[model samples]
Target chain A: MQIAILSGKGGAGKTLVAVNLVNLINLSTYIDCDVEEPNGKLYFSSEYNKKDINVLVPKINYKKCTHCNKCVDFCRYNALIDFLGKVKLLPSLCHSCGGCKLVCEFDAITEVKEPIGYIYQGDYKYHQIYGGELKIGKESGIEIISQLISKADKEKINIIDCPPGNGCSVMESIEQADYCILVSEPTIFGLENLKLVHELTTLYNKNIGLIINKANDYNNIIEDFAKTKDISIIGYIPFDKELAKLNSNQQLVSDNNKFKPYFIKIIEQIKQEVDL
Target chain B: MIIALPTKESGEKAFVSENLGRANYFYLYDTKTKEGKSFKNNFLNELHGAGVKTAEFLLKYSTDILITPRIGEKALEILLETDINIYKSTEKIARENINDFLNDNLEKLY
Candidate 1:
């Protein structure tokens, strides 16, 4: 089963939960889908084999071009432009949707491979680790995340650490998951954004659960919202200073006897929720 | 020479837009005819690349120069490749900038 860990707001402890959960689980594949700034690899010390990911972007053949502006008009990204007979392309803006190539009537456009990001594969103990790193100039890591997930072994349990926010990348990460764990904070900001991601999961019709991170007196808002939305509470990681210090020092809660039970309980609850 | 100003509204009372990409209207003033007109900028609401699309839209008018308070990097990239020269607008009113351009007072956008 694939479980996606996501949060609407940044710095809401999604990574903390994901790393701890992966370490506690029997044997699992952990995929860091936050290509722009993947932090999962920081906790897992391993020798990773890196691979490049490429996407096809359109290149115009000016000889056969009629300057009809069909490709320019078809590109919703506005990557294409025409100056009299000179056609200009801003390759970075291209989403590799191939609409421009399909719209060209004179066979003036052809696709060329462009490197967009990189995928890292490795192992930490009994678990497999995968990460996607988007190239510096690229905007969307959607393709990188897709390619990384495609490489995940379906035979084992997959723990996907999704990027923050309910945007395209987050949607892509959850699309293949059997269950989604929406992480939240105790603040009103967290509840509002949690509602956004919950609404998204509802829209996609996925099995959803919530984990209230940094639990304290302020958590009443998050609990009430979850209760109203009928979202199951998997488990809460207390806003304890020791846990934060250990986590900040790259120590896994699963490895420390003091905090192992917290994550173990979360795994047991997830197992029951998804029949794992 | 056909001069263009990124404007806030239609007609002579239209003020120059502070932004080049999401301007509400493009006011074109033909130097030979001493006549001006405003056309709605349909790319004003574009989520991204508004400047590039707006620049492409202005190409049809054969605009010799553009007057704006500021231009973004992406828009400036496309404009640099074209024959359209960008001029910095000193005033909020579109007519004042046009008069400045006619009197050689407005400076080229750096």
Candidate 2:
């Protein structure tokens, strides 16, 4: 079963939950789909095999071109335009549809592969780790996230750390996930973002559980939303200075005596829903 | 000669849009005839590549020169490909910049 850990915004302990869960589960695959800023590899460092993620962008052969606007009109992305009787192509905006080549009767268009990011695989302590890295200056990492998710080991219990927000990249990360774990903090901003993620999970019809970071008894706003949505509150990582200090140094706090119960308690609830 | 300027609206108070891509209207002035016309920027609502699209939209006017308060690299690249001489708009008012262009008071942007 694939479980996706998501947050409405960054720095909401999404990675903390995912990293601890993987360490406790042991013999599971950890796929980090946050290509833009994937730091999960730090906690699971080993000899990693890197593969480049590539996408095709159109290039125009200006020498053999006519002034026909068929290619420009056919492009839904508007990446191609007519300039001074010559065609200009914006590679960043191109979706690699290749319709421009198809519409070009003069055969003035071709595709070139551009390396946008990398897919890295490694293993440590009986856990398989995977990460996607997008190159600097690249506009979108949605493609890399999609390709990385496809590499997950289906047979092994997979725990995916999805990118933050309810955007295209986040949607791609959760496409095949069987269960969605929404993480939030105890603030109004966290509640608002969590609502969006909850709505998204409902739209995808996936079983969802909520983990409240820096949670306290007085955070009624976050508690109220989860109750209304009927989403089970699975776990909470309280606002504690010692735990934060230990986490920064130890990386994995699942084995620590204080945090073990909170991390372990959610396993039964997850298994019951996942197995069903 | 035909001149093109990115304008927020038509009339005396019409100012050059601070942003080239989001301009609501473009004012075209014919130097020989001394007549000006305003064309609605077609891609003002486009979420992406609006600046480049606006540059392409201006090609239909057979403009000889373009004066704007500011322009980005992508839009500047497209305009540079054509024969249009791009002049940096020194004045905020659309008509004053046209007068500035006529008087050769503006500097050419590479």
Candidate 3:
């Protein structure tokens, strides 16, 4: 079964939940779809295998170009701009639809591959993890994530750490997930974002369960919200100083079996829901 | 008066500008005239050094000056040479709040 750990906003313990769940599952393959700020490898201390991923961008040759606005008119992303009879290309905004090159009457535009990010593959003892790091200031996160998912080993149980927020990256990660684990805290912002993620999950028709991290004074509110939404409460990890200290020391929660049991139960619930 | 603000995407409100330290979008506000316009270029894409020419294209819209959170020294020097005032911004943009910015009430937004 493929499970995606997601949150509506950042800093909601999605990474924490994902790492712990991978530890609980033991043999599962992990994919970190949060290319913008991939921290999954940090907790696992996995070896890195970097693979450069590139995207096709439009390249204009001024020498052979007529200053016609054909390419600009063909570009739907507004990546091509024509000003004062000069043609300019914005490679970042270009989705590489290839329409510009196809429409260039003078053959002024060509497509070129530009490196956008790198994917790192490594192992955490018994488990395999693959994560990507987006080149700073790059916007092709969804594309990079799709590439990661395509390379995912479907035979092994998979746990995906999805990017925060309900943007294209999150959507792409959750699209093919067999089950989803939404992690959130008990704070007001957490609750609001939890609901937003829930809405997105519902839109994607993905089975979802909730994990309330740092269950402290806000447990009641989180529980109430879960009950109201008719969502199942899979597990809760209390706010413990020991866990914080261990986290500071870069220790995985699954390092201790006692703490690992919670994620084990969550994993079992996911297995049952997906019939794996 | 036309002013340019760097935005996450074009046609969206400027959340952070190049002068702003780190924000979602940037807005260029013209105080003398009540005109607020956002420059559409994906900042994340620009960060990858992909659309530098596109950014330069948007820079043409700046009639007088620009307001950002924090700009790189290189971009700062380039804008400086163009005779555009680069001021730092500390607030997000909304449709209504932009008019107040043009009327010299930018301090209230922050």
What tens digits encode model 2's per-residue C-alpha lDDT throughout A21-56?
Answer: 998886888999998888888887599999998899
Which has the greatest TM-score? 1
Q: What TM-score against the true fold does each predicted structure earn?
A: 0.89, 0.87, 0.73
Query: Which residue pairs show collisions in model 2?
Result: none
Decide which is better by lDDT, 1 or 2: 1
Model 3, range A1-276, lDDT digits (tens) per residue? 688999887877888888877787758888999998887888887568899988888888999988888887667665676643567665556777789899988988888998888888898888988989888756577778988898667787788899988988888998888889899999998888998999999898888889998889878788898898888988888888888778666679767866777777777777667765
lDDT (Cα, tens digit) per residue for candidate 1, span B1-110: 99999888888678898888898899999989999999998988887688888878778789889988898877787778788988999766888889988899999985
Error of 3 at A48 (Å): 1.5
Query: Which sections of candidate 3 miss by over 4 Å?
Result: A73-78, A82-86, B1-110
Candidate 2 local Cα displacement, residue A165, angstroms: 1.7
User: What's the residue-level lDDT of A274 in candidate 2?
Assistant: 83
Residues forming the 10-long window of minimal summed lDDT in candidate 2 chain A? A267-276
Q: Please rank every candidate by lDDT, starting with the best.
A: 1, 2, 3
Give the worst 10-residue stretch by lDDT in candidate 1 chain A.
A82-91
lDDT of each: 0.87, 0.85, 0.72
Model 2 per-residue lDDT tens digits across residues B37-86:
88888888887788888888878778888888788777877888788888
- Give me the overall lDDT of model 3: 0.72
Candidate 3 TM-score restricted to chain A: 0.93
